[model samples]
Target: MASLSFFIPALGKEPESIEDKIQLAEELKATDFNRFNELLKQVEDSSVNLTAEQHEQFRFLDAYRLAYSGSQTQAVANLTELVKVAKSEKVQFKSLSVLLNILIISRDYSEVFQYLEQYDQMQKNITDKDLRQHALGILALVFNQTSQFDIGYFYANKLSSDAVDGKYACFGMQFKLESLHRLKKYDEFDQEFDAGVATCEAAKQPIYSKIIQSYRVERLLEVDPNQAISLLNSLYQDVEQTSYNVLITLYKTLYSIAYLRNEQLDVAKEYGLSATKNIKEDDINYAILLLYSTLYEIEKANGNFEKALTYHEVLVSKQKAYDDEKAAGLLAYNIAKANVEVKNQRIALLDKDNELLSLQKDLYEKEARQNRLLVLILGAILLLATVLAYRGLTGRSRFKKIAEYDQLTGISNRYHFNNQAKIALDYCETNAKPVALILFDLDYFKDINDTHGHAVGDWALRAVVKTCRNFMRNNDVFGRIGGEEFAVVLPGCQTDKAVLLAEICRDAIAGIDTTESGKHFSLSASFGVSGSDNSGYQLKQLLADADSAMYSAKAAGRNQVATFSE
Candidate 1:
């Protein structure tokens, strides 16, 4: 509601009134860092003495500056002390807010939930309406991050409905739209999208408006990729001009997916790479997940399985870390909540005892029953927590396995194949051992699918894999890298040995009986062999050379092994 009189105050005429100082500090701390620092210096130098409360408020503002300006260690230390000692309720609340902001910035969800419990306890003592709305708005954001979209939506609705200031209203609407998008409440999202954008724009919060726009793009990406790319192109420059790294990464990731869906491989890879190259360690996990996952798909589509595997691994790792952090955060919050409940129960029991002091026997019996109930409830909570933790661990393991192996054939999928291949190649290179790669495709496989239907085709694929697996050595890496296509990486093997193995596998495939598949279909495969000595010891190059040789075999005649010449 107030504004700074000047960017930086002159030598002596620096706003002397405590109210002006507070207003100036609030205005410039987030938007104009240099001026805020100058103002802080002026406040420290001014001869006019301030009351204790005023000094505490100024200290809180200074902490806000520090937290926002990359000096979070000192800011957190200062705010931790200020929250406990500050006399004014507003200053205490502000300090807590800044501390929460720091944790959020660092993506420390566990500590965030821990502090959130403290903030919840203090909320009842806070009388300021705007501060209360601020708390609600931040709660919405934290819940959104923690994937509790329902709770996030509820808080955002409350904040929006009760907001007197446009700032809170903008944030409320922005997160509300996000929750709806994430929750897949598309009808409601479409209904509220325009109004939310208008509210953010009216508030002059370009960041929030752009965020809402990003949600629209995300939805469009699923249903209308062309439109998503067009909209992203429109917003590209504007997003770049802003300091919001989240939006920047999100837009680029969206562009990558949109282009990938549109079959624009080169452009998609470019955007995907650009987005991931700028990722920061402390950037939000949401952005990281989107960026890496999209890149994985893009690389896979572009036929770059090596890069695809790398991206897939990174995505899984990041997602696991994020889930673990969120779980810890929820655990901390629950622990704090349980402690608060226990303390409240004890206080209530003490009050009941004091009230019924004359009825001593009845009071003692009631207290004993209440304590027993408390113990049961706590034990149940602990058991539920243990079960959930076990489920999470198993769930992650299951997810990882599903991602690594093909569901259809139960062998390593393209991602895992490339990963294993790279490892084998690296080891071979280090040990000065030869490595060979074999690429094989089931010739006329689609004809089988079209003539006998996919059921028989699937059987043929499985049978072929079974036949080939019997010939593979223990150290050889075999995987289904494509539909009707497979690869094998053989370490400590020369080109001739690899070609022999391929011929054996090919003959086995041809000899397989097709009666078990319900319809008899003869299977034959084209094989290509490439060695590290010829392909320069790089997996990509090896794959390329083998692929070229495989096409040569296909061109000459199916069901034969061809070796790379140069």
Candidate 2:
């Protein structure tokens, strides 16, 4: 058995003394096997007098340390025992913190939240700002990992606000900025970044200064690659010897910027390979996919279609994996959108069906009434017959009007568009001429809805559609495709001509002015063009390819035109 040495707390600091020893034990337990063994040796060498409470604290600490530094099997056993012991008495704050830390480090986010609730309850009587800040910081991490950005932002902002002080404020601000970034509020993101930088500077905090500088590099990648590279060079010089997490982040940032700006295939590939090598494979999948995707784009631009396609396939797989969770959100949104569309279509169809039924019923009623009146006035039967014929003609005309056009825009409805597209496709197939399709979507249309209200969004969408219709050729088929998206089928147009025409349409739509709530705004659109290819494509494929191209345009920067190739 090893002899244990202990430091005694001062006479008056009984509870505080016990707390300090427990905290130390928790921290030691969090250390690695070697560190825990070293700590145990130190404990055995020191002699300290402890009261009943202090003895309990030491026992709990020892169990926790054993769990923390032990194998998974041993850790669980020790933790279970410690929990049993701690539960019998009132749980202390120090013990809870240690348990929570272990849960977090183990990535048990679900349990972390449950522990956080208990921690909050424990803090009810404690008014210490430091403890509150610590609790909130832990809570922020929990919310962030779970994609609860709003709640995470709330706690992080509370911790960062001027009400808090010192290092906690800096950590809170960093977390808040991260939450803002995730939410895609880029303008607000920049504001938060600047504020964070200023706070760190004012506090003279080196850790936060490094963190902010690393974030700056990330932002700089969006707008100016050269500036980002220059900043990274300076940062590397300062932290070249330090193998810290921040250093890893900075290296990844540098690699990303270089990969984006470098035009030459060999150079870009070289840098990308270097980056992939430098970062942990599992940690930076998004960055890795981005690199590969960019390289693929470069290859495609250079006309290496086969190589581009290969990289694209890989990129698609990685993107699917990345978007697996968001896939549900997107699918939910799409399903809701589709359901609304189906409902509207069903209503329209029902209205038409009902109108026909009503008209026929009215005609039958009129005829029956006429038959009755004819019996009374035999001489006026001719007049009644003429009146019935006129009503029938008018009813037919009204049904034609309803079937031929959309009620809202007076343009062709989807039924009309589909019929026309099929006819045009048949014509092109017979005549051996090319037909093209252009798909357009308003960029950030949802943001407009969120900011200016849905009514304004609706008005803006209608205005854009109206403008798009005005730009269409006489023979072109155009119709709205759900909210803020539209499709144009151009018969007798080749790929090159379709590209030029799509650009014209994109520019025209971008120039439209929309006003809502006394504020004037301009909107841009992404355009995707697909023409007849020798690969024997169907209408669905044409539409899908064009939509893919449009998304690419949006990704590259909206208000741009992209033509589907291969």
User: TM-scores, in order shown?
Assistant: 0.57, 0.45
> What lDDT is obtained when candidate 2 is compared to the true structure?
0.65
User: Given candidate 2, what's the lDDT at residue 477?
Assistant: 87
lDDT per residue, candidate 1, 341-419, as tens digits?
A: 5457667767877878868878888888878867776888878999999999999989998999998888899999999
Candidate 2 TM-score, true structure as reference: 0.45
Backbone clashes, candidate 1 = 0
Candidate lDDT scores, in order, read 0.82, 0.65
RMSD in angstroms, all models? 24.5, 20.7
In model 2, the worst 10-residue window by lDDT is 1-10
Runs of candidate 2 with Cα error greater than 4 angstroms are 1-52, 63-92, 123-129, 162-165, 198-208, 239-241, 245-250, 262-266, 281-566
